[model samples]
Target: MSTSNEPVSFPAGLEGVYVCNTTLSEVEGLEGRLIFNGFNAIDLAETRTFEEVWFVLREGRLPSQSELSTFVSQVEALSHLTLDEYKLVKKLRGGEPMSAFRSSLSAVANGRGFKSWMNRDKAVVAEEIMTLCALTPEIMEVLHTGRKPKLKAGNRGYADRYLWGILGKQPAEADLRALETYLILTVDHGLNASTFSSRVTVSTGADVGAALTAAVGTLSGPLHGGAPGPVLDMFDSIASVANVSNWVAEKMAAGHLFMGFGHRVYRTDDPRSLCLKRVAERQASPRIELAKAAEAEILAALAAKQQAKALAQNVPVRTLRVNVEFWTAVVLEHVGIPRTLFSSTFCASRMIGWGEHIREQIAGNKLYRPRSYYTGSKP
Candidate 1:
């Protein structure tokens, strides 16, 4: 009984809808700002652990000492994968590491106990966070190295323990801290494309696992959250300080968008990138000098080339100023994680925010079926 001629009112630009709202996070896309539980993302990136950030996103506040201990214990307890789960991850490979990770997560969630565990309200959020944080290393290990990794038990920071368990070796404390900061910075960012996709899936009554899986798929697109690796690759190709300007100019001449140069939001510098750059500087890897030089040259070239480019200063440049991507690449590289794993790591961290948004959508009980104005075949 659907009428093709019925005057279907649309929102023109997909503007107003209470599709989802999360108290844990908000993004002012116009201003390029990200906040988590009333705290600026930069503050969390500088001062908090990944677990602390996760606690804030799920429970609405940074955890106290005792709460942090309890949360860490819970997370550590859920870090291990069963024999069958490990086997399954080992079986799913030969493509993009992020894609493999997403597929593994989906398959593991379909295992018998996963559904029951995910459905429990008292521990659902914490459980989901643990699964995401833990499974990432497992999936990465299986895909990149083609080996089953042994779980390590000890008193290490979450990021340290994660990299250690995956790579089967202890990471330097500085590297672990840098990775932790990266995770904290990336944890949540308003209702971004991927987060919205997660909310949409959850609105259909899908469990947290399915919603997170959907979010990962959305993030795999280059336009969304898939640029970090390419950013590093660009830096590598530029190679030295002197070639930076020429390299950028050449890429622009060829009609290629510079990866990690400008952001869709943020008229000013990205605050998160600023904080990350600080971490990168402190880490002080060899690539730091090269990265900084390239960044400076790129900015100079951008300013000279186009007034409207907005590329003279942005998050990526700020990150390069601090050598953020270089340091991240260095640390991750040292830990045996391939460049391809960067996006997967991003997805792993952002899953916390996605889950929070999904819960918000379910609570609001609204379907996000936005209508569009008819612009085709009206016969």
Candidate 2:
């Protein structure tokens, strides 16, 4: 190595950067493992309800039967949006679903008196969390259907309520289970872009609403939480298995991204993709079939053209595999969710993680401050 009088360079996009330490979750990209509060996320994805996982992430352990019953009751009690909140949601309808969700959630959280939760005890903060969890799906329901969410006074887990409340009908057993698995898988994943946004906002002593609002805005960007719907769009355009090769080739030649095929962190297959693929298979919807066929065709085409070095300098591109968004779109479509509500659906589940992370950040209590390299002229 040659020495030079120059500033040292860091990884772009903060890849492999450790911003802060936490007990929230760990993303082992190479190993394709995710651990949440010491529980294997894949195990929780298969065996636990969203409420159960929420309790684990927030309280550091899974809930007992009594604890789960009480927790479900509390979450249901907090799920209903007041009349004023509904009216506010109405005013914000007809915008992009994620955009509407962000504004409407901020309005609902502030209207419910956010200051009461700010700087309060964990229970109060948890109430604020439960409020967001309860309301996010409601907001998505109204935004998608232009109707008030159907509130039911009965025992239901958070994921089940979201499905039934949004559709205004009891979801099918298979559909409900599919959605439950989706919610559990997405509840948390290390410090993603949106979670970091929340942690940063909360670190500066902001309320949960402010922190979550920051998260929602960050999540709205296409680079972060906006790929699921487009994956469905890609499926629509491809339309059949026969067209997959030509479609992949044309898009690849034109330098267009295959919406659901890549991820930032996973060098190996995204384990969530594997979990969701099984759900998609069990659901057995036409869209899932199309997505699966397209995924296989794309992979085969990539492998065949590996010697050509089509997209990268490496002999093969590991990112040319299916990611969580591909199967997420398949499963969400299988469950009858509207495409427009995809990212909001993501937020509905991810809000649990956001709330838990904000609480953890506040408990640790340090402001985030990072230095930047300056390349412009300085006075």
Clashes of each: 0, 0
TM-score of each: 0.84, 0.92
- The number of residue pairs in model 1 that clash at the backbone is 0
Model 1 misplaced regions, further than 4 Å: 1-18, 28-33, 113-133, 155-157, 308-336
Candidate 1 lDDT over residue span 287-376, tens digit each: 677777766766666555555443655423332122234345554554456677777777767866776676666556666675554546
> Candidate 1: global Cα-lDDT?
0.69
Candidate 2 lDDT, 186-229, residue by residue in tens: 88999899999999998887778889999999999989878889
Clashing pairs in 2: none
Candidate 1 lDDT for residue 256: 72
User: Residue 291 of model 2: what lDDT?
Assistant: 80
Error of 2 at 266 (Å): 1.0
* Error at 250, model 1, angstroms: 3.0
lDDT of each: 0.69, 0.82
Which prediction has the highest TM-score against the true structure?
Answer: 2
